[model samples]
Target: MPLIDKIAWLHLHDGRILSTRSRGKDAYYLPGGKREPGETDADTLLREIREELTVTLDPASLQLRGVFTAPAHGHAPDVLVQMTLYAATYTGQLQPAAEIEEIVWLSYRHRPQVSAVDQLIFDWLRELGELAE
Candidate 1:
């Protein structure tokens, strides 16, 4: 199977999680992207977040939450995506930037709107009572 390694930012609010969709995408994804060479997950994530969401994540407040993998959305059947997820506090407002076209707070009820891996994350969060909405 082909593998795509990426990082994700998990920002929660009132039992919901923040999700974003790019200009031409159909499914919302956790706000983050793949790591560039010579960059750590923190480095890649911070830059991606700022570029996509216009927010600066607090390095001191960043914490690894979990890693998840599933069939890569919008890719071939044998392709998979492995996501390293981090929870962090940020400065500045969350707004669409770059290719981002929409930002929404997602609950378990909205699981179908996200990608396969994101649905798994929602399931895990719901079990922990963090995404009960």
Candidate 2:
């Protein structure tokens, strides 16, 4: 099976997590993207967040949240996505940028609207008492 590697940010507020929907996409996803060659996790996180959400993540504030693997959304059953999640403090207003078409805060009840890996993330956060029922 092929694995698609990605980095994601976990920004939670009032029992909800930040999520985005890209242009022309159905499922919502965390506000981050795949790592480019020669980029570390921090590098990818910084770049992707700024590009997608118009915010600059404070490098020193980046914290490892968790890593999750699931069947890639909209892909072959054999394809997998490994998402490395991080929690961090950021500057500037969060807005839809780049390919992002919408921004929303989602709780556990919104699980069906997100991607496969994101559903796993919602479950994890609920288990940790961080996501709302």
| Highest TM-score scorer | 2
Taking the tens digit of each residue's C-alpha lDDT, what string does model 2 give over 18-117?
A: 9999998999999999999999999999999999999999999999999999999999999999999999999999999999999999999999999999
Overall lDDT per candidate, in order of appearance: 0.95, 0.96
Query: Top model by lDDT, which number?
Result: 2
For candidate 1, the per-residue lDDT at 44 reads: 90
lDDT of 1 by residue, 26-82 (tens): 999999999888999999999999999999999999899999999999999999999
The ten-residue window of minimal lDDT in model 2 covers 119-128
